[model samples]
Target: MKYTIFSTDLTNPLAVWQHFEGEERVYWHDTQVNRVIVAAGRVKRITEAELADYPWAWYSQSFFDTIEDPIWQNMGNELVVFTHYYVKEEGKAYWVTATDSAPVIAPMTVPSVQHTYEMVTTGDYTAWQSLFEGIQQAIRSGEVTKVVASRKVAFHSETPFQTASIIGNLVAQNEGAFIFAYGKGDAVFLGASPEVLVRKRGQDFMSYALAGTLKKDDIHDGGDRLLHDPKNLREHQIVIDRIRQTMLAMCDKVDVQATHIMELPNLYHLRTLLYGHDTKDSILTMAKALHPTPAMGGEPREAALAVLKQFEPYERGLYAAPVGWVCGNTPLFREAGDGLLIVGIRSALVHGQDLYAYAGCGVVAESDCEAEYTETATKLQTILKAL
Candidate 1:
């Protein structure tokens, strides 16, 4: 139950990720706070029951096991990895946390290589139409109120993709996001995500209701139109109501901040931050309770998920799942330390020369198939620009 700390340079943290080419690695960079964590090499495989002993670990879980897919299955479909080598970088200071005393590791040289690739959508308009029709039918029939629909696009390159390059590009181009890269051998799951599933700092807990989206184009009034659009408002309110109820059940006191627009490089999201105080639940517990929060899974959680399972042509895997890290020092200790889990939207999975990127949007009864499709395609640009 001991860890060693040592000084290290993290000016170019992506180089540190490249250094451990042969080992499993996990990278987490919170751009808002300017904090980065890079962990490599596995010491032990952690279970749900072992959270107390190894509270500090990287967590990545699949959206849900709706279908069997080997690509994601090989990448540890539904597993959380605990590593021996962990490094934390905040501002100008850098330090390592490990289960054993390890030597000062040097960053590897990341070669500047230009890559060429072709892109193809996994599903076509007809496929998207079918899914949209299905969801609309369900909503009209009162089987479900809203359902989030998603699709995948694949990029095929002549040469194998470099994980370090992608990570570096994501950090440089994307702002106000949690930049992440999790790699094991030839497969890597990476993205720049803006939605927080849940974040815990001691007894203070917070979750974001980020549902409505609008392109931040010159034609539109930035986020002003998104703020007043009735369809978008209804979609966003669904998320706020669900999260508020869940927080109230677990917390002694809860407060939802004023609604505002979360502006990303490509789009704007209606965001309402919720806070819960003095909770006995742990980070993992809070994350599990709030994941796929209408923002991803849709309204009446279970019913929407069922609709997705029946209509979504591709497996979501970790696309919109809860992915993050947890920290603590003792058992049954809800008061221990801090942790944050973010919804894995705007993400991609890399296998050798093939990279599959995913994006989704909420579809209420009033949603139009063509409009939703365009929105999702625009959202995919977050990862495409990085590539």
Candidate 2:
């Protein structure tokens, strides 16, 4: 199908987001550049194996490996699909038309939404902590150095959830985050994430490694305590070392930065920035290689992945998976245009009156069960406030 582009103006892209809220739609606010895109239509779907060839593609992680739990059947396995999308940039909204002659256009007016949102949760805080004790025992037994133990906040309400308003609020409050709203079937996966899995601009690639956690309210020293904490440092360093080593394996040249503090509304993290020129030709390959970092999967990837599959209870689905687009028929995603993907951290799944929010903490030998439980709560506060 031939594509067309028409430029217009949009001050509140959320209006376009509201108008385009369909069973299948894409909303991406490029945090790197000042731009927003909302694409809607039933076009096509592609797999990860097919992703390298197409530039206009999007994907989410799924746990096909773990089949013990039945809750995951709703989301299925990981996905990488292609779709023509709209772009709003440089104070102009561009309508990305598909192969058909009829062109899609952005709505000209903003939407007003008013409703009461009430939610009740069945939180797995204590249970998740119990699992962490097991992880701690495993760590001491030399089974693994670290494992990310996570919890779920399953919320159900009588009132219908307002996605547009929630997304708009997320955008307004977190300018530094990659704001997104992804809808499929009866479920929508949405969040404002602060982690980048990998971004490919030509042969240049960048990755962000974030681990360790401390609730901001509890940190009386304003990160002085965080910077010195031994457990947090060890957890954070594991992620840093893993990412740097992995990237160096695939890149011609690489730069790994010293650890720094990354503060959020409710918490603080030990963050590192890494970048390099990839020796490989494909951006998709670079993304797959970086996912399930020690931050998500734990040290000794293969063993940690096995632990996660058996212990995480619910399938991870897209909690820490890669989500972004690539261009089709291009030698490089950057060779044709720009391509970016961010880790789906600080994310949740919303369906009808039920919403399942997820948060995780990297568990190590020194991990205290109560402290790890509190860290997950701190992470959940991000989406809790948005909800």
Each model's lDDT comes to 0.81, 0.71
Residue-wise lDDT of candidate 2 within 95-152, one digit each (tens)? 6555544243455644334434444654466567667767777778898999887777
- TM, every model: 0.92, 0.88
Model 2 residue pairs with clashes? 55-326, 55-327, 55-328, 56-326, 56-327
lDDT of 1 by residue, 1-387 (tens): 555555655466676677777778888899998877777876666655565555366777678854368777645434354444445544454544555555455656676556688886655788999999999999999988889999888889999888788888888888999999888767889999998989998888999999899987767687988899999999999999999998888899999999999988889989999999999877777777887799999889999999998988888888899888776554422434467889888999999899998989999988988999999999988777777
Mark the regions of model 1 whose C-alpha exceeds 4 Å error after superposition: 47-55, 65-67, 74-88, 97-104, 107-113, 330-337
Q: Tell me the TM-score of model 2.
A: 0.88
Model 2 ranges with Cα > 4 A deviation: 47-55, 63-84, 99-123, 218-221, 329-333
lDDT of 2 at 22: 61
